[model samples]
Target: MDIENMRAFITVAEHQSISHAAKELHQLQSNMTAKIKKIESEFNKELFYRKPRGMELNEEGKKLYAQFKKIVLLWEETRSMMNEDSPVLRLGLMVSKNPPNFDDAMKALYETYENLMVTIKTGSTPKIEEELVNGTIDIGFLVGKTDMNSLHYKKYGTEKLVLVGKNIDKPLEEILKHDNLIISSENCYYKKILDVLLEDHKAIRSDFVEIAALESMMNMCQLGMGVTLIPESDTARLGIRHYKVIDHSCCEIEKFISYRKNHKITGVEQQLMNRIVTAN
Candidate 1:
């Protein structure tokens, strides 16, 4: 039996609705309906009784669902246990949270797969997207709008952006008139928001500096060089002053884990994905 079709059968049976099952599986309703139909044709049996409410499994479907559940469990266990040196998982990270918080997930991964190699690169969203398309990276974490139809993404969390400064004794209005701004590279999404905010405030700067690294940006702000926008969670321990944006729409960013839609997900990849999605 086709494993995907069997899996689809199980999902539909559990949900008792093809539309719900299709949404959960990230597949179109028509595609999911076709898969179920194909499975029924293969077995030469009607697995579900069509109804106005939804699909209800017939006797044969109940029997096959029970067996398929065990089969899926066994296959997952086997795949998890098959340990060997796997290809490198090239990951791209865009945000910087100090005291690196992914230790537990990394430890769990190493324990589960002893020989798999992992590499991490940090860059802007556009830069990482280019790398992903060129096969230089396998997966990436991005913040902001993701409109690439050729890629797949799961939104895991949200980060709040705030204007952070060091030892500023002046009001926000006075600070806006300083004409000095610190931010990331030109391609950064945060930088774009900062530009819009500056324009709205009529505080166009002739002294805006582009610092590529998050640590460096914070350091520059600490030295009273200029104010910068940073993720709110990252400013807790830095003893910095952060202000909520006057326009609240640009302050919240949706965090996503993105990968190529056509790439096959392996057991290891799925485990790592689960850990990341859960941890965040």
Candidate 2:
């Protein structure tokens, strides 16, 4: 019934190896074994079966895992809602991709709570999460489920990202002969996706721009200087249009907010988060 047992169970399910799970959970193998056993005993069900090679979930274990996952999510939500301060909420926003929604969210969050001191940190996920762990920032808007240990996640919205270019069409063969290719620096996650898209199409990237600022990239796109690809929703804010890669779609980055699973914040951050979401 304890959170420790569920934690151990989830880790083991992820790796399917007791030793690996123990390492991941930062506990000794024997200790994790004991915790798992205690939980199984309490529930009166077999959680995992030791095969000749490795551990596999039994029918009961699978059912338990499914239920436990939902339980943990709800438990964390309830815990967060219960603990909050009205004074201030330190927020970190990593710009994995610029958005039509994110800017609106930022503005609404800042304006809605007049008394709350909200410090906005803007950078890549790696940059923001470093601050999150170092106690400089309380929450981070990052991409996907990273291996930041014990971070609780809440998903917001998804914007479809595509490879884009100016005066470009669906058939890429005719377009490849042109000399211009747009790229932001490696700091942006969108840049990484663009690199792969270029390589896949056998397109030579003769032009490149390394703009670290999200606003700067949009400015560049609007000038008709060169073509750039960005999140579809994001492009509307800028003065340019975008086209999707019907032939080649490589990746979709998930946007999520992360905070320490143990550190609960209800009215402090959630109030602003809700305001921004409602405004959008």
Top-lDDT structure, candidate number: 1
Pairs clashing within candidate 1 = none
Candidate 1 segments whose C-alpha is farther than 4 A from its true place: 1-26, 30-80, 83-87, 95-101, 167-173, 237-247
lDDT of 1 at 1: 85
Reference-based TM-score of each model:
0.69, 0.56
Instruction: Return model 1's CA RMSD, one decimal.
Output: 7.4
- The whole-model lDDT of each prediction reads 0.73, 0.63
lDDT of 2 by residue, 1-280 (tens): 8866886886687568888788655689999999889888988888789887668889999988877755665554455445533456677865545333556655654564455566778776667777788778787777545567866665555556654555565456445446344555655565566667667777766456676665765555545444565666555555555565544545565666677766656544654554343333
Specify the poorest-scoring 10-residue window by lDDT in model 1.
95-104
Q: What is the lDDT of residue 14 in candidate 1?
A: 66
Model 2, position 153: C-alpha lDDT score: 63
